[model samples]
Target: MAKGVISAADQAEQLKQDGNTYFKKNRLGAAIDAYTEAITLCPNIPVYWTNRALCHLKRNDWTRVEEDCLKAVQLDNKSVKGHYMLGLALLQKEKYAEGIKELQRALDLGRGAHPNSYMVEEIWQELATAKYQEWERDSTKRSWELRRLKESCETALEEKYSRDDVSQKTDDTDEISNSTSEQLAALKLVFDKAAEADTPTDVPDYLCCKITLDIFRDPVITPSGLTYERAVILDHLEKVGKFDPITRETLFASQLIPNLAIKEAVEAFLEKHGWAYKMD
Candidate 1:
């Protein structure tokens, strides 16, 4: 090796460092240029592509973000940043199915690598949002189909008896009407039962404390970012162990923070569904 010549890998490392500096300063264009040069020098390095994709994401350049993240994931399939950025880009383009798929992958990988990390929480939140949106859209479609079916049934019934005999049709009409009502009542019972099964009768999982498996009266957050009832957690801290039960991570009484958001959520839920209070 020549004394004055720098290796391509070394040069790429230097460029990557420069890109990090530029990104920290919010100089996205310069950061992207540096990352691009690093990527050119070491195309197999997933970090460079992922870094550049982040810059594109900030600029709302969904197409470019998608391209860079795809390249990054191809280089390393387990790249969390690659899948996360690609999911965000696909979501921006309203590709819900593909976006949710990528986000789910990112969540799985991030959770495995860093169970209590903020990145894993972010992935979970995004995946949950995507799933909810997809469910809502599908629900709307199902509602429309049900309405159409009802309309079609009414139209068919009206057409069937439109030209029946005036005298004899009266008895026949009454019998058919009774039979149709019975059939419709049976169908309604089936639908009502299905709806009851689908509707949640218990407290939401978020509102319940993991330790007590009951709705939180006073929620507090731990350093691990999990919420639990204040009294239960304090009791656990005193008697059980100095660790988060769910994450098995070291915890201290001083590290507990008031989870005001969750507290407010529980209050609102109880206000809307007062019967939940008796759901023992």
Candidate 2:
């Protein structure tokens, strides 16, 4: 009986090795079957769980991938592959915040020794993309709010001027005219300052570009390149400036604006160029 048991254990070990070979060949279904058989023969082995997790990942069975990864981690909390697999599985589910935390934990646990730099970089890139997307959404909301505020201010000014004109017909002529002129002067000053503030300052264009690129290159927040995010921000700023009366002309024609001042430059360019934009 003991001899038979020992022979069965040896067979299970052979089956596990065969599963690994199949996995290496990208024969995921066959690898899964072999790993499953090995687990039945020796359910205590952590290798079986780990190998099965790899097959599940290749098949894009994220739930099973997560299950097997947790099992492996339970068996050996120190397993770097276990934590990495969990993070990848969570990321695929679009649970970005949780996925980032898990990936960061994997890195903190000294998983850098693993020969998977490309995979690690991909994970980091995903996290960065999520963060940048969040930021873009927030910026959009603020732009809309600023547009509404400008419209409200304009409406209030119009209402106040209309009231003053009606009152001027019934009040002292000289006093009412002087008051109207003083108010108009103050309003003109405010409008002039707003227009002047729309253009970019003296910062170098290249420096602005470099700073924007660096923001997108951050491993934790912006893993991907800056092209996509930068384009989106520029496009949005252009739209906002065009629709915003106070900022429209001032943003379009400024020669001193830096190319890297993407937001401010777009506003200035739109204002200077009479808010004309090609949709293509």
Candidate 3:
């Protein structure tokens, strides 16, 4: 209560931490604002400049990032992070010679200070490989560079989602597979029932159509109060005459309604004696 005013160093440090928090949350604009405020409060902090450069890098503002990273290096020539970010920015802008120089410098510093840093990631290895591959063919080198671009994108995605709870990922693959299997089983059952109705046995006279003299694939009724297979009845109406073959009564093919009950009985019979269908 007595000392309400914050010290400049403490305030700047707090702002820098706020920027880090915002950056972690992917609020790049807010993070940049916080880092800029921190830099204004404490211009000598090279890390603050480097942190702001990282936010700009996220936005793909390579020019702005290059400027910030260059300033960070000017303040602290030994800043490995500053050189790394500057190298990435220049590389993104296709300034390969300058970018490679800065990256090699960062790699050299990283080897001395921290051997297991971002410089050891696949991106660096791929670039190094691509630089050498360039001697063989320009197209092959471009392909490697394209892979590097994709590698950077994947790295950014990893950074964003690395903290997410992977355990909560709802996998519906089993459910979909089971559902498809069940549907196919149901379809097979229907086909089996239809085929079983054709079993070898003395079928009931009513179940057999007079035209084909066999069980119906699709049974239909006529205006003359007789049922027959649809194809047989239609053939008789079109080829023979528009009259019932057995009853000799005038009938129309358009009068056919599905004999669903008969069809079900036939299907049940065929299901029981599928061998009879082979005999037919």
TM-score of 1: 0.69
Residue 267's lDDT in candidate 3: 67
Against the true structure, what is each candidate's TM-score? Answer: 0.69, 0.49, 0.46
* Model 1 stretches astray by more than 4 angstroms: 161-180, 183-207, 210-280
Off by over 4 Å in 3: 126-280
Taking the tens digit of each residue's C-alpha lDDT, what string does model 2 give over 1-280? 6654566678789999999899889988889999999888888777788889988988889999899888887887766667777877887886756766666666545434642354554554554454344344444565566667666766676676667768767666566556656866776666556544332234324323332432221111112222223332344446665221322333221222223335445445433532222211
**Could you tell me how far off, in angstroms, the CA of residue 259 lies in candidate 2 after the best superposition?**
33
Residue-level lDDT tens digits of model 1 in 87-151:
98998888988998999899889867875567875786676567556655655566676667766
Best by TM-score: 1
Compose the digit string of candidate 3's lDDT tens values, residues 9-105. Answer: 8899999999999999999999999999999999999999999998998999999999999999999998988888898888777677687688777
Residue 143 lDDT (model 3): 46
